[model samples]
Target: MSGLAASERSVRPSSGLSRFAAMFGKELLELVRSLKLIWVPIVFIALGIMQPVTSYYMPVILEKAGNLPDGSVIEIPLPTGAQVMAETLAQFGSLGALVIVLVFMGTVSSERNSGAVSMILVKPVSPASYLVSKWGAMLLLSSLSLLAGYGAAWYYTGFLIEAVAFKAVLSSFLLYELWLLVLLTLTLLLSTALRSAAGAAFAALGAGAVLSLLSNLFPKYAGWLPGALPGFARQAVMGSLEWSSRFGACLVATVMLLAALVLLANILLRRAAAID
Candidate 1:
C-alpha cells in the first residue's frame, strides 16, 4: 500500500507537468492563429522606423522654421549624433509603453471573459500555470517587439550618422527594452486582478499616472517608481556607469514591483480557480 501511494504521488507530478506544457502550447497557438503574432511585431516595427526617420529630419525641420520673435535670432544648435539618437529613442520609448498596454490588455483578462479559462482549467491545468503562461506570452512578445524596434533604430541611425558605437547603442536600446518589461509586468498584474479587460487597461494607465505624480510629490523617492524606468533608460543610454545610490534604488524598486505583480496575479488566479 505504501509503494502504491508513492507511485500515485509521482504520477501526479508528471501529470501536472504535462498540463503545464499543454497550457503553454495552447496559449502559443492561440497567439499565432489570432494574428497577435503578426500585429504586435508590426506595430513596434513601424514605430522603430518612424522614430529614427523623424529624428533625422526634425532638426532640419526646426531650423527651416527658423528664428523666433523680438528680432532675436533663434540659434539652433547643430544636432549632435547622440542627441539625434536620443530624440528617436524618446519617441520610440513612449510608443513602446502604449504598445505594451494594447498587446497585453486581452492577454489574460479576455481569456477569462471568453470562458477560455474555464475550458483550459477543465483540462487539468493549474491556475498558477495558466497565469504564468500568460505572463510568459506577454514577455516573449514584448522582447521581440523591442528587438525589432532596436534593429530599425540601429539601421536608420547608422545610415544617417558616422562613428556610432555599436556596443553603446545596443546597450542603450536594451535598457529601454528592459524597462518596458517592467511595464508589461505591471499590465499583467492589472489584467489578472481585474475581470474586465478595459478596466485592467485603464487601471494600468492610471497606475502609471499615479506613479508619475508620486515621483513629483516625493522627489527623493522618485527612483523607486515605475516612472523611473524611462529615466533609467535615458541614463543608461548616456553611459552613466556611476554606482550611484539611485541606481541601487531603481534596481530594487524594479525587482520589488515585478514581484508584487507576480504575487497579485497569482492571488487573483487562485481566487478565480476557487470560484470555478
Candidate 2:
C-alpha cells in the first residue's frame, strides 16, 4: 500500500482529460501490439468482397457446381447493386459481429487478470476514463475496418452489378456502424462484469441474438430496440423507407440506450470489489 501510494503521487495529470488521453493511448498501443490492427480489417474486406463477387457469378457457378439431370435449367434473377450491398451488411451482422466480439472479448478481463487495473486504479484514474478509453479505442478500430470493407464492396458492386446511390450507401453504412457499436458495447459491459472472457463473448452474442429474434417477432412494437437497426440499414439501401416518426423514434431511442449502457458499465466498474 505504501509503495502504491508513493507511485500514485509520482505522476498525476493536470485534468481528467489528460488522464483519459493517457489511458486511451495505452489501449491503442495494446491493440497494435496484438496485431489486431492489421488482420481485422483484412478479414472484413474478405467477407465484404465475397458477397458481390459471388452474387455476380452465381449463374456460372451454378452451371459448373455439379452435373444436373439431362434437361435441367436454373434461371435465377441477378440482384441489383443495392441488394448486394444489403447482403454484404447481412454478412457483417453475422460473421463480422462475431469477429468483433472475439477480438474485444478480453478487453477488460485481461487487464484485470494481469493486475494492471489495480495499479492503474491506485492513481488518479476515474472509472469513466478507464472504460471510455478502452471503448473509444475499439470503436476507432471498428470504424476504420468497416469503412475499408464497405468501401471495397461498394466499388466492386459498381463494377459487377448496378451502381447503388451514394446517399443510400452512406446512410446504410452509418446505421450499420451504430449497430456494431451497440454489440461491442454489450461485449464491453460483460467483459467488465465477468471474469471469463469466453463467457462474456457468449453471453453478449446470446443477448443480441435474443433481441434480434424478438424484434423479428414484433416489428411495430420493437422498432425502438437496437435489433431494428439492421432492417433500417437494409431499408436505407433499398430506398423504400423514409424519414418517419418510427425511424426518428428508433434513432433517438438507440442513442439513449447506448448512453445508458455506458453509464451502467461505469457503475459496474466503480462498484467492482475485485478486478480478477
Candidate 3:
C-alpha cells in the first residue's frame, strides 16, 4: 500500500504538469483571440521607438515649442544611448505598466465570476496549475512585449544616440522586467482574491504607488523593496550601480515577494473553487 501511494504521488506531479501545459495553451489561445498578441507588441515597439527619436530631436522640439524671444537658441544636449534607453524604460514603468495591469486585471476574476473556473475545476485540475497557467501566460506576454519594446529602443539608441554597452542594456532590461513582474504578480494575486476586476487593478496599482513612494521617501530602509528596482535598473544602464552591494537584497526580496504572491493566489483560488 505504501508503494502504491508513492507511485500515486509521482503520477500526480506528471498529471499536474500535463494539465498546466494544456491550461497554458488555452490561455495563450485566449490572448491571441483577444488580439493581445498583436497590439500589445505593437504598443511596446511604438513606445520603444518614440524615446530615442524624441531624445534625438529634443532641441528641435524645444525650439519649435518654446517660442522663446526671437532667435533665442535652445541648445539642448543630446542624451547618451544608455540614457535614452533608461528613459524608454521609464515610459514602460508608467504607461506600459498601466496597460499590463488593465489587460490582466480580469484574467482570473472574470473567469471565476463567469463560472468558467467552476467548470474547469470539476476536472482533476489543481488550483496551483490553474493559477500558474495564468501566470505563465502573463509572463510570456510581458516578456515578449518588453523584449520588442527594449529591442526597438536599443536599435534606435544605437543608430540615433551614442552606442550603449550590450551588458548594461541587458542587465537594465532584466532588472526592469523583474520590477514589472512583481507588479504583475501582485495583480494576479489581487484578481484571485477580489471579485471585481477593476478593484483588483486599483488595489494593485495603489499598492505599487505606495511602495514606490515609500521607497523614494525612505531609500535607506526601503532599498530592498521592488519599487527600488527601476532606479537600480537605470543605474545599471548608466554604469553606476554596484550590483553585488546594491541589488542583492532587493533582488532577493522581490523574488521572495513574487513567490509569496503566487502561493497566495493559488490558495485563494483553491478556496474559491471549494466554495463554489
Question: If both were scored by TM-score, which would come out higher, candidate 1 or candidate 3?
Answer: 3
Model 3, position 168, has a per-residue lDDT of: 92
Tens-place lDDT digits, model 2, residues 16-110: 88889999999899889988888999988999899999999998897898687767888889998899999999999999989988999988888
- Which is the leading candidate under lDDT? 3
How well is each residue in 1-276 modelled by candidate 3, as lDDT tens digits? 999999998766556777888999999999999999889989999999999999998888887887688878777888878789889999999999999899999999999999999999998888888888999888988989999999999999999888899899889889988888988999999999999999999999999988788888898888778899998989999988885654788889898999999999988988899886
The worst-scoring run of ten residues by lDDT in candidate 2 lies at 267-276
Candidate 2: stretches off by over 4 Å = 1-13, 273-276
Backbone clash count for every predicted candidate, in the order shown: 0, 0, 0
TM-score of 3: 0.93
Look at candidate 3 and tell me the lDDT of residue 253: 89
> lDDT-based ranking, best first?
3, 2, 1
TM-score of every candidate relative to the true structure: 0.82, 0.93, 0.93
- Model 1 TM-score on a 0 to 1 scale: 0.82
